[model samples]
Target: MSVTETVGQTPLEAASPFEMRVDLGKDVPETDVRSALKSGEIGFLHSFTTGSAVDGPGIRLVAWTTSCMFRCQYCHNPDTWTLSNGIPVPIEKAKEELRKYAPGLKAMHGGFTLSGGEPLMQSRFAVRLFAAAKEMGIHTAIETNGYYGDKLTDDELAYIDLVILDMKAFDPVQHKRVTGMDNAPVIEFCERLAHLKRPMWFRYVLVPGLTDVPEEMDRVAKFAASLGVVEKAEILPFHQMGRYKWERLGLDYKLAATTPPSNELVAEAVAIFRNAGLVAD
Candidate 1:
């Protein structure tokens, strides 16, 4: 279909990543979707939000991909858990969309960031899109869980300008508790980037009563400190903005009444990273 048909007259524009977007690719056959994922010619995007400064350096245009293996209890966009929920867009189309903002993005020192339910789930699409963005002279970043960090070849990884790794937890048990996944590959990815001297920004989500453990965060902070490539460490306080999505989708909303982390909590987390000699905010 066309962009107009997929979502309005232009590319899908979401007010924010928290906006509920679903069934954009519901009509595609399973076989075709699988083929596209393997080829990277087309990507399944949940939505693309423009003018985002929180995702990366300066103002950014961030694309949110669909599908993820982790079922983090604090996850806000539960709608992205299924790949088929995304809108199907060809690689060239995505490039065209990026091309439109390339000039302004460069002028503003901003670029493109492909975030996700877990972007590496659509590894090929993300790599190809990053390459396209690079060719356009636009900086590229990925906000990822680092679970599928191996999906990008070293050469492919070079296409990316920065990696905003959302390293949830360091301890395997806590990692599993937070994101329902292994932490080994995530750490390995961080180490690999350090070895390559690739620039990185580490982010940890501070959830009340769940991931607020000082010892656990200190471990993560120290690990990020050891990486040497982490230029910025951001402690993203967990918010309930996505709680409505779960309620609407009829999914079990565990953190139904969970509030955002207090300011003191945020400051303490930042201090932990700062104490490790890393620039933090």
Candidate 2:
């Protein structure tokens, strides 16, 4: 399908190359996330965790919201893809949850990170959550795919201390193949964040035979270099750790035989970005 056709269709309606395990019977209404900001209400949440270091600098209280537009084949959190799967947590209640970790987070020089399935899907909730965290003297960050970067207003972006932007693919066709969506929005989001001078960490998953191509890696590295605000580039080695989730969800496991990239390949990919003048690992 063309990018325009895919853009207009919801995940359920799109002709995904992979077997998707979405419930067509369940009608999840499109949430007016902006209205939630005005009402000071809760948002759909998958869960939250305390003391995660890999998510951001120091320990972090990472809140994973529900719903996502992409059906990434290598996604580890397939269960988080549906809105109906998550519980609703009030904005104030979410704040209280963050408060429990605030002291610890502050002492450790850590912060709160709003994460997937896609935090931007619940933009208002994230804004409110970040605002509350800042008010409590806690730093705030977000791990986003950048597809919906425009959702957050300048005021909302002000509350975020860092942005971990996941750039899936440098090639448009490959991007659409890996994620059942176009790369235009993601690239545009990166540009928007750059224009705003947002501190960012670029993340890319290295799937051995899929995204480890030298030419594409070079393009990705060049793009990252162009983003003057990028402080770090993380080359995440893809693994089968999330394969069980796909099986549990009854979705086709396309990469069941796929292996993580070799150490040499990882180093090579890292070097591509590092050579571009960015701190890569």
Candidate 3:
């Protein structure tokens, strides 16, 4: 399917070639990744990391895939949102690099994490990659905004050991205004994942006057509670780390002049979600 067609469509009918998994024979072993890497057959390009301290439980081999559906004003890696960006490398290459970090990751009881640009946007590739990792006995996690859950099947969900969900905003109108997308699908995705009993970490970026509002926190807390599987709800204070990227990319930095929320404001927002019974960390 065309890129435009798949951009905002429901997951069940996803037809983007970039997001679909390409089978390379059932018996292909992880050892073959080296050759695949050398030949440049990776379906979606990835930014590989040997050890990432913040992504999950332990030091992790994080694969930051390129491609996202949202256009959030405060997004850090604005370059990752477009489909045509990033260098292509074979999936094998990614696996091989991750394998090298396996021992260290294991020591931390951490394995691998698949992060953006909206890793779920390329769920097909993610599914195959995670399956291959599992075959190698690696634990897996996905850090997403829950934007593509409709396209994700139970089989796909089963492969993921953990999910870090970003709840951008609680007010649908404000959410769309900030992210250029509706909040319903993201909200519904969380509910569905919760029903599946998936382990989840819900994140909310405390965007000063934009997202740290008490009412908004209550709404998000209400929605998160409905999911029940939320292990923790995090309030991430907004920062200007990506402001330069926006300027360099020739994109308007809409939130450039906005200041981050004060520590007291962040604390208040955290308390709101905390009161809802979600472990606010």
Candidate 4:
């Protein structure tokens, strides 16, 4: 299938800095955004949630965007893989939504997290939203796979306060097996973040048989340690929670019978990173 066909919409055009940039406290009419949204100049989002604690530090307003390049085997939201599957909310509407939760977020030391089907797929929108959030004095974070990390400019990234990066695997072959993508871009993204001294939380999913290998875990631990800016390493135990989504979508669900890692295994994986002198849980 063609890229557009696979995504169920044309990919966003490369946006010039002038077009992507948004000013703080400026209100743009919703009617004015139709042309941009239709042209993929803005973003198509799956949905947004308020008071989500797991996406970032403290409570957060999490925006889940649509369309991803990776077909991760463990993805719970397979329906999010296509652009047409989402609600086409313009960037201004998104900012308005964030505005509702801004005061509470700040009072609680919380923030806004842009999550996805890879938020970086709509890099321009993410950058704009983050920039606006910073203007409101709200902490901003992104939950990304890092494939499109190169899309953001230094000025745009300056608006972001933290990153929650998901590093699927340390080995190239195994990484491809899990996410159907190369790890090179992800590694490059990590290196770039390190160079920027960006604070980050590293996340890894520990599937019982698929990713529980000690040697592979060690490689991940070592890489996390080398990144100096990693504030935390989260060892997420894999679960079959999303298998139903694959079944409903009529896609073959791999790892259907693969069980979640035991609590002991989770502890061991956390220990590996802790042993490497990184804070892990």
Candidate 5:
């Protein structure tokens, strides 16, 4: 049964993206779903949370969408993998949600950011949302894996002020092992963005035994440096905050025993990016 009847078609703003949500949009007819996807009339959203400082340049109102192509082992919100787990919100409504905070956001030098479950999974919706943010004179950003970067055309891409790309791995084998997908498309997207002169910030998660390989990180640093469009590289230390999500969803948690990377490990990763002549933190 679609949870729309059991619950509500519209979702209240979530206190945090970590809150579990399920089957919120399952009641919509298949035809309607397809229409929404094609026209960008609506989007499947997990929740909207305000006052995020790390997602973009300033404090931000971040919308967490549903559906993703990558099956990353270290995913924090496994529930977001299901499209129906998100509420089917019309684009206008989503815009209104942004409008509510526009004044304060502008005053704070903040804007809007669309994050996911891979925002590009709902390509049309993602573009439309960015456009709406731009209309309101707010800065816009998207956090993506770049697997479906082609989904947005150059015109549509203009609305996005920044692209916060989460890079899993640089090596093909390691990338496949981490995301169960090849990184070729990702590299292509990054190159395209560089050619377009789009400012970018690349983030690498420092998973001790998994992604902390020195040579691989060095390659990534070099790539970012070569891009010339990468303003900064961020080395994120992996954490166990999302382990319980995997358990609750009955998925195998591969990194259950893996502790967060030590400070020394994180420093080394940062230094690799810095040595490549890209500002890293």
Candidate 6:
């Protein structure tokens, strides 16, 4: 099948900076966006959550889009890692789902969140989705690995309300080894994202000896604090809830021997980032 058929829509016109830049590499030009949207060339998304309290500040409508370019060892959603794993529901349908919880969202002052195996992996879809959400006055957020930030246009940056950047590891070599990619893009993405002056949440998975090293945590903390855009620094205690996915998929459970960090350990990591002048949540 063609890429368009796979995704189910031709994207809307490249009306904003984000759209034009994101689609710059394509054969289609920005001038053709309106026609494309009218022609239904841009396919809408599949599904989304109506109410999620954990992803952002208030209750949130989350769109967990399928597809990812990375293969992290401890990923909780290995099932969501593939582009073709889930049913395609369309973006309008997704919005309809979010509306069901609109009353709750207004009560909690919450909005919409887009997350995935790597949302950036589906940047085109994300750009389209964000545009749609923004038109509806929904406060939009993204939970991403920061790998695709640089590749986007400035206009795209304007649509997002918040960005929660996940730092896989402070050490580049370890990060590449663990996540099957280098850390340079992730780091560069963060720095460029800072220029947008959007609220950012830097999250790290405290993987015992692997990611909890005092020196490394300090380095990460310092880097994040230096960014000046971080609204919150969160230390996510590593867990094995997804280990079973790896087992079921017949993939190697490299971190299988690893245990979750103690609350004290988590606290210590939190302190390091906090001490560096970043808020820890």
Model 5 lDDT tens row, 87-154: 88878878889889999999999999999898998999988888888888999999999999999898
| Clashing residue pairs, backbone N/CA/C < 3 A, model 4 | none
Model 5 segments more than 4 A misplaced: 1-10
Residue-pair clashes per candidate: 0, 0, 5, 0, 0, 14
Model 3 has an lDDT value of: 0.72
Which candidate do you rate higher for TM-score, 3 or 4?
A: 4
Per-residue alpha-carbon lDDT of candidate 4 for residues 1-281, written as tens digits (9 for 90 to 100) = 32223223422222210111111102324553444444444566666767778888888888877779998888877777875555566567678888888999999999999887788877878888898899899999999999889988877788889989998998999999999999999999899999999999999999887889899989988998899999999999998766766777789987899988888999999999999889999
Full ranking by lDDT: 5, 1, 2, 4, 3, 6
Q: What is the lDDT of residue 168 in candidate 4?
A: 91
Question: What TM-score would you give candidate 2 relative to the actual structure?
Answer: 0.87
Task: Give the per-residue lDDT digits (tens) of candidate 6, residues 1-281.
Answer: 33334334433222211111112113333444334334333422324555577788788877765557778877876766654454344456555555666667667889888887677666766777778778777788999988778756888888899999888876888888668898898888888877767789988888876777898889889999888899888899999877776777677788989999998998888899889998896
Alpha-carbon lDDT of model 6 = 0.70
Task: Estimate the TM-score for candidate 4.
Answer: 0.86
How well is each residue in 182-207 modelled by candidate 2, as lDDT tens digits?
Answer: 98988988888889998999999999
lDDT per model, in order? Answer: 0.89, 0.80, 0.72, 0.78, 0.89, 0.70
Task: Extract clashing residue pairs from model 2.
Answer: none
TM-score of each: 0.96, 0.87, 0.83, 0.86, 0.96, 0.81
Better of 3 and 6 by TM-score: 3
Please identify model 6 stretches exceeding 4 Å from their true place: 1-47
In model 5, the worst 10-residue window by lDDT is 1-10
